[model samples]
Target chain A: MITAERKPLDEIIAMILPFKKVLVVGCASCVGECAAGGEKEVGLLGSALRMDARMTTKELETREMTLERQCVYEFIDRLTGLIDQYDAVLSLACGAGVQAVAEVFPNIPILPALNTSFLGQTKEAGLWLENCRGCGDCRLHLFADICPVTRCAKQIFNGPCGGSQDGKCEVNPETPCAWHLIVTRLEDRNQLDLLEEVYAPADWSKKEGAGPRKIVREDQQN
Target chain B: MKIESQLKNVLAAGRFAVTAECGPPKGADPEAVIKKGRILKGYVDSVNVTDNQTGVVRLSSLAACVLLLQEGLDPVLQMVVRDRNRIALQSDLLGASTLGIRNVLCLSGDHQSFGNQTQAIGVFDLDSIQLIQTVRRMRDEGQIIGGEAVSPPPYLFIGAAANPFADPFFYRVIRLAKKVKAGTEFIQTQCIYNLDRFKEWMSQVRDRGLHEKVYILGGITPLKSAKMAEYIKNQVAGMDIPEPLIRRMKSVPAKGQRKEGIKISIETIQALKEMEGVHGVHIMAIEWEEAVPQVVEQAGLMPRPTV
Candidate 1:
């Protein structure tokens, strides 16, 4: 899930302060799951904004709309005719959705109403914690299903660093040492011998720094 | 005294009764819900058990409230008409009454797009005002929506929400009036961080005699850290943190600032308690329920009012 938190009420108010007619757009995908840019948040934000505007003696004509997935072109096309109805759009989607909206409606200003945090899972209900960095490489197989790129303090690719103490990271005691977790998992699976294999430095070319990556599936392509 | 009798006395005495909200658990675990109910039992006259709050699936508020009632706590079963139609709402209401749940907070819940189940469809057959009216019809007229005489209509202390800080401030007062007209006996507003603005709204309510008809509870939540304060300020709608308060939050070092957060919360409660037209503080510590007792104590309020 794309974890996002609501943008500050004042910041949101300032973003749409100049607009009379505004549409609060909610994404029904990742942001929604994180409870940030979902329909409920849209209503809450819209209602809160409306209340704030009323308190300020300003009249705001606010309407709310939620798409199945804001990142998809098909969903973006849903707002084609409705584009001109609002002065601006407060997109409650993730960064991807916001960009998608901006790409589709070049004329309208698309404002993000949420701060896209990171790729995370719900640790518990109403609580989501980050777990992945999307480093564009799948090294979980090499590390017994743990991604050192995200869990490690220094993003170490090999064995535990000196900062690792008793299976806990020294930088933050609450966080477990990623290498320790890897070692424990490898030991459990009887694959501790894999630790002997020295992996080369990560190839940055195949990662995000190389630019936008693409996957072409001949079976699915027209 | 029973909450109803106390409420009546408070009303006659021209004082406001305080109420707070508690969202039910998302799963079968009732520990959090039970603890919240117990924590708020004597501190608040009524605790609102939100029904699948924000459209998120949870243990039914009715069931949670039943447990609270068993513990000798007053539970206000918050029914969101967004998911349930008239039939289900009425059935739940009558069922609650039969189970001795006397308070209810009617809301048009968050749309299904906000919950774990995005494909879920919303059933907003009635908005909050309409739900209040429906409850009133059932209570006062002893008639259901179908006009059939309900053998015994449920008597409930109905509550609703008012966002004084909602944009277009004029509409806030207008909405409150509408809710009152529709049968809201009490209103628990969104978080109150901007007391000046809240006071202005209260003055308007007072001038319009709206305060006379309904008790108002101020919603408050303590910031656990500067980051949390920033989050609430930026992300949480209907929540406003003044610059001074923000500065105070920021002054505390990140490592050991939880104590500072508690102090800030205590101060907020103390200030809110002294504010005119502010009946009581609804401490929404969110996950910080343990600090509520200290806040109430610091604010010089008895955990339970002797009156």
Candidate 2:
């Protein structure tokens, strides 16, 4: 899932300095799973903003609302009549959700409360690790299911790099070297020869380079 | 022979080759490299000029190799893919070759986090295996990675590093074979303290008939002190210094431990010479290049083999 984290409290407070009325919008998807921007986080941020307004003797009217999925038009349409009352909408969602809201309501100022991190997996409670780079092409089959493009510190297709010591990446001892795991696991399965040839340089054509990548379902469009 | 390097010639002539390493200075000091070369001169077949080894920035290996050449010492230029993309690596290979460097050792170097700059980016455009293949194509086929032709291609005796003690020990030999299949003419291993494990790895190498395909050099680093021994055993990554060696160093008094370290290194070389599929020994006297002559002399490999 796309992961995100709430921006620093001070930065968010400063972003709303000029606004008298504000809407804190939350997404119940990826950000909620990562605990970065959920309904609870929206309440926490709204309470902090209200406390700041009271302390500074400012007239600040803040309203909190969470959609089932902020990236969807139907869910965003739930706030159709109410969104025009706020000076700005602070979105506690992934970048997609913020952009979706902006596309629907261009008249209102859209502020991002959460910083989109990566497509990641939760290692355990309270810990998230990026597992996919969304390189558009996947070679996880060759690496024994460990994604070297995202897991390896250098994203080396032909590894383990000399810096991989004792199966741990030199960049961080806590992180396991992706190739070490790939090689050993492949060896165990009696398929060590799979990594013999040099992997061609990654094809950049499939990547989301300068613009947003979109896939059109031509068969379903009609 | 495919490449005419002293080390390659000595290895091909069915003689045991002795190689040493000399790290470039962290500052602009060619004199320091020359001084180290003088000590290594006539004592080893080739001296490896480390390329920002251990991710610590120093004088460029290409420049250091040139300085070693000026001092009449053959330099095996070590090039790592940690800092350069394919464009830089290919151009650097050509530049080093134009400057009369005949030997090259390609590797995916130590991570930048371990160096002075912890936040540096690593550009491993090609790992060691691919780097070896790239050099071979440039030499044998006059082409770059994708077989694009180059005018007057660089001819170099390619070398790659192997870690027999790395995890999943069974795959170590397979990795060596992959590197050999990638077109490396020679192989140098990580520093050795346990001869038994190295012998096991060599047995695996020989079983695969790789002995006849490439020259395998066993790496040996002389311990400077018992503290260094403990540090290597406990702290250094991928190096497997045996407990007995550490005990032997600790058993001795502080003054005599360096000698003991050299003694153990000599014993390892003597044993490695007899081991099947082992072609030579690479004496990595880290920061202790002056001890090269002493170690070579004591190892009975003195007055190094002539090409």
Candidate 3:
């Protein structure tokens, strides 16, 4: 899922300082699952902002709401009526959600309260691990289901570079060496032959094309 | 005349090859590399110029190789994948070939975090093994990765680095075999302080018959001091400096440590010369180029053969 972390309170406070009233919004999708931009987080942020406003200028007002999903237009449209009451919308959503809200209510100031980190997995309650590079092309099967393109620090194709030691990456000792994991899994399955094959250089245009990427299903389109 | 690799020719003639490293300067200064090259000339076969080794910014390996060539030294262009995509790597290979570089060593370079430029993004678009195959394809097949034909192809001796001391030790030999299969003609291993583990890796290479498929050069870096040994053992990733070697270095007084380092290097060279499947010794006298001639001569590897 697309993970995000809340922006520093000071940065969020600074963004909404000019406004007399603000809406602290949240998304109940990936950000919600990570406990970053859920309904509870919205209440926490709104309360904090209200407290800061009361202690400081005592001139600002805040209201909190969480949409089912902020990226989609249907869910985002819920804010069309309530958005006019607030001077700015502080979104506790991923970058996509902030952008979607901005597109829906083009006139209002949509400030992001959270920084989208990565497309990651919630490994545990307090940990999120990046598991994808969104390279546009995937070859997980060739590498024993381990994605070197995403996990390996250097993104090596035929690796475990010399820097790999004790199954740990030299870049970050905390991170397990991706190639070691790939080679070990492949070796366990007696599928080491897969590594013997030299992979061609990736065509990066798929991921880094001329501009933004889009997908359309013509059959489902009205 | 098929390929102009002097290192390959020396190994082909069944003579023990001698190679050493020449790191490019941190700044764009030609004399630094030339000075090092001059010291190593007449003492080694094809000095390997490192490519931004340890991710520190330096004069390019290609440019430094040219400088060494000017000093009447055959240079091995060390190309790392850390800072280049396929296009840049192939372009540099072609440029190196055209500039009279006969040898190229492919490496998935040290991570940028270790260097001064810790914030720099690494561009490992292709790893060392894939780089080897890319060179092979460009040279043998006269084509780029996209099947585009070149007007004239490159003729080069390809090499890659191996680390037997790294973890998953059983797979290190397999990785070497993979490199050999990828068309690497020569392999220069990581510095060997743990001879027992290296010999074990060599045995596995022989078991798989990979030793016969490619010429293997044992890496020999002379430790300048006991502190250096300890630092490498503790701080340097992927290096396997056994405890006894550090203790041995410490056994000697501070003034005599350099001499002890040279002595250990010579002993390693002699041992590698006797080991089966070992074709040469790559003396990496890091920042101590003056010691190469002494180590080579004292180890009875002087009077480098001219192939």
Cand. 3 TM to true fold: 0.97
- The residue-by-residue lDDT of candidate 1 on A1-222, one tens digit each, is 788888898899998988999989999899888888888989999999989988889989999989999999999999999879889999999888999999999999999998989888899988887788776778789889888767865455544543344467654667787877887788789986666554533544465565787777999968
Pairs that collide in candidate 3 are none
lDDT of 2 by residue, B80-100 (tens): 988998889999999988888
Deviation from native of the Cα of residue B144 in model 3, angstroms: 0.6
* CAPRI quality band, candidate 2: acceptable
Identify the runs in model 2 with alpha carbons over 4 angstroms from their true place. A56-58, A68-84, A99-109, A161-167, A187-190, A195-198, A208-222, B1-3
What is the lDDT, from 0 to 100, of the residue A219 in candidate 2? 93
DockQ of all predictions against the true structure, Cα-based: 0.01, 0.47, 0.74
- Give the winner by DockQ: 1 or 3: 3
Question: Scoring only the second chain, what is candidate 3's TM-score?
Answer: 0.98
Of models 1 and 2, which has the larger lDDT?
2
Query: DockQ score for model 3, please?
Result: 0.74
lDDT for residue A60 in candidate 2, whole number 0-100: 95
DockQ of 1: 0.01
Candidate 2 accuracy as lDDT: 0.87
Ranking by DockQ: 3, 2, 1
